[model samples]
Target chain A: MKKINYNRELCDFCGTCVSVCPQDAIELSENNLEITDKCTVCMNCVYICPLRALEVKNEG
Target chain B: MKDRYDVIVVGGGPSGSMAAMFAARAGVSVLMLEKDREIGLPVRCAEGVGDKGLRSVVDINPNWIAQKITTVKLISPAGMEVVIGTDEVGYILNRKMFDPGLAELAAQAGSEIITKAYVNGLLLDNNKVTGVRVRTLGREFQVKASIVIGADGVESRVGRWAGIKTWEKLNDMETCAQVTAQNINVQQDAIHLYFSNTRAPKGYLWVFPKGNGLANVGIGISGEASRHKSPFAYLFEFLQTNFPQAAIITTVAGGVPCAREPEKIVANGLMLVGDAARQVNPVSGGGIVTGMIAGKIAGQVAGQAIIDGKTDEKRLAEYARLWQKAEGKKHKVFYKLKEFVYNMSDKDLDDTAKIALQIPQDKRTILQLFKTALVQKPALILEAIKVLT
Candidate 1:
């Protein structure tokens, strides 16, 4: 299973991934992006990035 | 023998009806199931749609229209209004009649419509959808079909049951409450949008006139800050101040998904359309056009598959491919854009409004406006600027 590896370092603090995630899996804490347990790998943020910052990691 | 049809469309909304209509015209037997006893009763919409989006399919019928609009007025958070001059090219549809009328058109095209039929589950065979189990009129029955389309709106359970990942985050969803009130003093020719933070924190409020002193007054706020208070509470506050003299006629409350793209609407042997697919506009919370377009494509693919006798996941991947080919890139881009725009601070919005107000009325191209408001990569902004313009 591939998991999303959110690069907090590169994130623009725009919350695009947070709003586009259908599962409400992403939250913003003090301008830092937090990936929650509810994530279902929708990839809405991965695809919706204007900055191309968020990445995904698949687990074997 | 178990019964079977070419396509089983769940939800008799416009998209489902259009799907059934197109598939039936392609010579496939179609069955449309609507949970509501009345197909278009208790209307739930701002009732406005762009003219270009409607012209692609059916001509705008006069009977279905409440008003034909020609101008739009956008107000900023600071109460500064900018009236744009575009070809007045939209209609406030009388959904009560228009919705049922579209279903009737589907029936005329040889599709069978079953109202009051609530689909409770999807019948799966060998990990693939084969039919649906529905309860209606105090009885339960099952119907088999080659293709199943989930056209049920915003909070669709069918997509979830089929493992399509239909969840919407609280912050991404816009809780909406609207009402059509009579005896109001509002501009009948132009739509009014209020963008003040005091009115809506994460979203905006709108007043769409339906002619003859009637208008649909509504507001939507992002679900993130709206956890404690209901959408009705927010809308009531606005109504009390703005339209205090207006008589209340009807009220509607629902959630609108503002996500740029849905998780996945297409899977092996199944597809979703309309609000179920989250095909709505990211900014406006409008889905009528996008849903209709998706339905047309899904209908075409389903028809061709039935003719070829290949309704499996591999074969149905074409629909997914075609959808992405048609609007996937735009959806991806819009998702990012929506996030950036929604995150704009009140000060940012105020400054942007100042810039917009400075531009001469004729010089307001969407590109110039977005660029002036945003300080992001030109490529993404340019792409979005071109698409919206």
Candidate 2:
């Protein structure tokens, strides 16, 4: 399945993903960020991230 | 974590600390939670604040200020410069210390503070915010409180959970990128702002000096404008074109809400402050002072309401009413001004710059510039009268 994946090394935790999340799936505190189950793989976060920290990849 | 408290403040920024400080000072038990390992690590803001407005809320600490500025320069799209000598002073803060200083005041006021405490969810009782479900170091706790203050920054889950509609529309959201750079070739006495739709649509590029050969250079573009090309692209171009030799030390990107219409800041047993409430100035996209102001008012109201044993929506409306009168009403006028000024074409801006140049340097104020340049609209003149005076 094609699933959304997050790369912690690149994430800035600036909450740009939270700002654009249609499902409110992204929860971002100051130092940490989590993508909740409410995510529908809409790809808004992937496209808007300035660092390209989030991506879509095949997962088993 | 305790079983219950009078007020629980989420986040430990200016707004959160201000709220916690005033609430605790009013003879209530307050808890201020910060998710980060330290209170002021990983600075996110442009670190700009007005001296006069900042003093109204907290004491001035010279140790926290990087630079104190008195003059500003505005660059037109056509490269015309309008140098403005402001009556009020501005400060570029070192938020690594400034934020924690505010939290220190909150602690001194008797608010219990906990860092490395992440609030995952809200604890609700009958659809009203009763507490927070926070996680700390692989352990979870249901910390209860009579009122929860959401100073949780731009994308606030606390405000959203309280049914406060804290989302920002595209027009009001600013996607920003900033870098602390060294060896920038510019005067350090004045803040420089450049405006152009092609460069920064519906926003401006800024260079705030930090005194010792370092500067904070940044750009903000509307969320809608950034959809095609990210702010990173614009900043990269800006650095290449302006200060190609400057070395970058730190870079950050974030979303700042500059909403023309603020959300309902108060709900049953819960209050929102700072960026969470969209209390930011619409024109400048500055929120620190306004957030501090909102936090003070919310804390006082939350304290009084809790002391009276009533923490319902009806009782909490005082915060909304007071905030509207305090800063929200003026923000409405500012948003109108932003719409008027930024919507002007490059030709119009160039024309305004020409007009502004005719005035003596000592006589040029922001109000005078608006009065002369905004001669195109009669309705706007009426608004100008209400605002400038």
Candidate 3:
């Protein structure tokens, strides 16, 4: 179960994830976006995202 | 062991208090926490609320109001003023007093509220939100709740703690600074908006009256434009040249996100309301009414979910559905419209304003004004007509 997942290649670096995530799990660190905490995998960010930058991936 | 709460309301702003009040009204065990020693300290809003929009949720209290406005005077960059008249424009509230009054209303509605308490994060059990860990006065404690309502404002931490995306892009945010001042020359009852790309690119300056030659004058510039100078710097220059005699009484500087909506507003047993959810208007940057509206919907749905004994993501998503259905469609349209509007050049804006002033005042519908501003074809105008009419 990949607890934290995002495609940096796809992210527009919009910071939409920073404002909407409830856990404060996602933040732009060192100008590179990183998902800090293991997200609930709710897909709220992936779904509501206008750019479709993030998604849930199985943590193998 | 402390008492269990049916709903834990965090951040004792208007939205939080409203959530606590509505939840407690349903006979639920509600607890509201305010980090500040006193609620509504360091006020951060223009305090304007439309009469009709506000009446949809709570009744108006005469004592809470500061000034009753009937007209809005909009000024273009070249100083062309357009007056919009309405029977019930809005009231510029005394928010320092009004915010606490809302919390008092929640208390009166049987909700227990504590001041000087900060919520650290959510207590998760089996990946479901169960409670919150709070730190108050150097002491840490945990409180369990069946449901958690995050009424935190623009810089909401609770939303992030629960795993909801609370990030706002720079383009979607307006850096604003306002001041309450005296000796203002603007009309007493008319709210004024000064639009100039040079003054506030991607945003506008506002002069809202506070009665008796006093007013709250402010300006918001989008972050992209603000790279050259801060909103405070731009506003001070404007005031020095325009209203140099005015004496400042108080100042408020903050960020207002212009999101069509937040990245997400719901997750499992948690929900974000008010500015936390990015429900502020895309154009005017007003959030009080929309926040309260979304708060009522979120609180009502959260309370029902608690009574039903289920607080999962699917169950709580009703809050999101309710809010989206409330104004989501308009927001989508506004987002698209904002992109188009902001892309206009300074000369384009001045020219558009000149053309708009040519429209007969009585025929100045929103559609007509928009058409004048943008050289849209009849098809686009018709599309807008269908949606608006």
TM-score chain B for all models. Answer: 0.93, 0.95, 0.94
Which regions of candidate 2 deviate over 4 angstroms? A1-5, A30-32, A40-48, A54-60, B376-389
lDDT of each structure?
0.75, 0.85, 0.76
Q: Which digits, one per residue and each the tens of the lDDT, describe model 1 over residues B1-389?
A: 13688899998888888888888888999999987778887576788898888778666678999988887877777767777657648888899988898899889999998887878789888878888988777788888998998887765757766777766666667767788998768779888877755567677889899999999998877776564454567677888877888788887655677775656776656888887888877777788877887887888888889899998878877877887887667676666666656766666667777787788876765556677676533435655564465
Give me the candidate number with maximum TM-score.
2
Q: Give the candidate number with the greatest lDDT.
A: 2
Interface RMSD of each: 13.6, 2.0, 10.5
**What TM-score fits each model?**
0.82, 0.93, 0.83
True contacts kept of each: 0.07, 0.39, 0.15
State in Å the error of residue B323, model 2.
1.1
What are the RMSDs of all candidates, in order?
9.9, 2.6, 8.1
* Model 1 regions lying over 4 Å from their true place: A1-60, B375-389
Candidate with more favorable, higher DockQ: 2 or 3:
2
Task: Give me the runs in candidate 3 sitting further than 4 Å from their true place.
Answer: A1-60, B1-3, B85-87, B376-389
Which scores higher on TM-score, 1 or 2? 2
